[model samples]
Target chain A: MEDDYYSIESILAENQKIQCTFKIDVPDMGHLDGGNERDIKALSKVQVPLWMAYILIYSDYADFTIPPPFSARVRSALNAEARSVRLSNLVGQAGLWYGFGRMIMRLLNDDVAKEMSDVLVKTFRDRLPEVIDQAQHFASVHASSADSGVGGDNATMLFREGLDGTERELFALAQDSTRRTKRWYETSERGRRS
Target chain B: MALPTPLRASVTPAELELIASEQLVEIVPLVAMERTAFISGAYGPLRPPTKCKVPIWMATNLKLKKKCRVVPPDWLNVEFLEGRLTQETSEAGFSEMPFRFAEVAKVLLDVAPDDFPNPDKIRSLLKDIREARQAKSREGLSKLDHSELSLPNLCSMEINEIRPFFIRAMGVLTDLVKEAQPQQDAP
Candidate 1:
């Protein structure tokens, strides 16, 4: 997500669909495909959801022109230099940076990927660490200085009334489990000894 | 294929939580539940052959009574999970998988290792993938920036190691998004 600054959600929601033609028949695989039950025949053009197209294309099922998003063009226009980290993040923020980058990387096997694989690698390699650096820097501030807005808000930020991402919830649960297990183990062991 | 909403292209923090919480196992009642009440909540008037989502404790209770066929979650089979483990290890990104896949697999292996064709192999493979993913996470954490940090080719266990960074990132992300949002009141 941070790679280029794009979220998968934004990419999936905002991106336009393109026509793709299958190289093989995609039999009725499952219900997730929005009720397209019939086999997608080879050599026939079908308008596909870009997300769906991504899967099919990767699996060697079909092909399409994967349009470089505006974020892609931003990176391309800036000569792929480190000078444009903030600029690219600004633009990539519009579309979720690394997501678009990773999506393009996923397309590396596609014909287009042949020409600019280097750009994709450099796009991430050069810029990604910096992106992480920026976040980590901010996180560091948030972690230490209580006067910082992020730091001061930490308690309320957590335990706020809303759904946290799954991992946060899970981590808390794991800690809770560990505490219980330790208590039980200590109690049982003490009982056994005494 | 894209996993359902709760699923992700990679192993996520949720997977670990789900595993820790323990996923439901399929239980076929040898005797009718007949709307029986239990501590967790109201359970079946469940009939035979129909599977009920039962906790491990309850499932064991049923087994003791010889009351039901306790079919493990679908991923219990060695054949099915071996394929998933292979994908987790090999694929650049993984398909959506159940939340507590690794933990459930562990439980099933511990409880009924006999059910699987190759429980030991599955155990070892899962461990290797986990270790490899943890290494990647050390690399990933050194470079963390976003809420959705892609644990490329990694597993959920690694997510636990880096939860603090991600949680902070998420908080920052929400704030950034709010800041970035154009005010409707402005021209």
Candidate 2:
């Protein structure tokens, strides 16, 4: 609920769509559903941006189904092996699986919100070590490849492809730090000699 | 135009190295010089063949000019690092390491490889220690709690490496906790 107005990431995450069923007749909102009708009817299901859906749900005007990305099937897949699951493919265009899940948690009741948040936290924890390992591995490869002109790991790239937005950012951060340290180690002597 | 982003959640490794350079190191000067005043503090008269303590930055500068030989820190040797590596691998929690070990070791090894015996072996040992410690840190992160994360004895570089991820993860966790709070109060 603490939406930082300046965060582009949060804005992009809010752009994801969720299915909401209107609880009552709504006037002049048919454009939302792309229907010819001038107004949305009661119990009508429509896909709305997450931001708008949150507003509708918060005001008790609509009820939203849990998105397929956070469905029981995904939960089982994550429980089986979180690192292997392709979280990048789970969410909408933003690929903000954790971000989206956190937003959704805000609209749910206590028990369901707790359960969903647990899944989000567990998935993050399970996959974080791999994220760090891959970042470090690629960093070392990059440092050495600059001299040897060798190619990067294909399997690592395949694994990296499955990272969600949050994980991607974390990977980039870890990679940048490792790269900076390696550069410092390799270049400090030369820079001084010159 | 590319506007600058907000401040980073943690200091970069380079910045940490710069800070670590303030730590004093023993150096044997090949050329004699009178006691000199530096912005940080005064360093004593540099008589030839006698070891004197000076900040790492000054030592590295003098060392680069081949005017001094750096005395590698007590723990910078192969045997000590190998022992620490074993402790790191065998322990559940992080082993006690110097707070600025990573930065200091990297700077010293890079600047004064000839000063330390078997520099390559020392480098490999240090790398092994780092890997072992990193694996331990990752295990700690996997057990991360929403309310708190207690990891003692983490070095500066390791802490900085995890800072961005930790801050964001904690933010997400706090948000989730907040979400569940309102419902608990509703009854």
Best by lDDT: 2
lDDT of 1 by residue, A80-118 (tens): 464343432332323343334344444444344433434
Off by over 4 Å in 1: A1-194, B1-22, B29-32, B46-51, B64-69, B146-148, B152-158, B165-187
Q: What is the lDDT of residue A163 in candidate 1?
A: 19
Q: Best-fitting candidate, measured by TM-score?
A: 2
Listed per model, the TM-scores of chain A against the true chain A are 0.39, 0.90
Q: Pick the candidate with the highest DockQ.
A: 2
Q: Give every collision pair in model 2.
A: none
lDDT of 2 by residue, A1-194 (tens): 23689877788778889999999999998999998989999999999999898678877899999999999999999999988888888874438888788888777877788898889888887888788878877787887676564334675565688888878877887777777667765665547542
Off by over 4 Å in 2: A146-159, A188-194, B1-7, B178-180, B183-187
Q: What's the C-alpha lDDT at position A176 in model 2?
A: 72
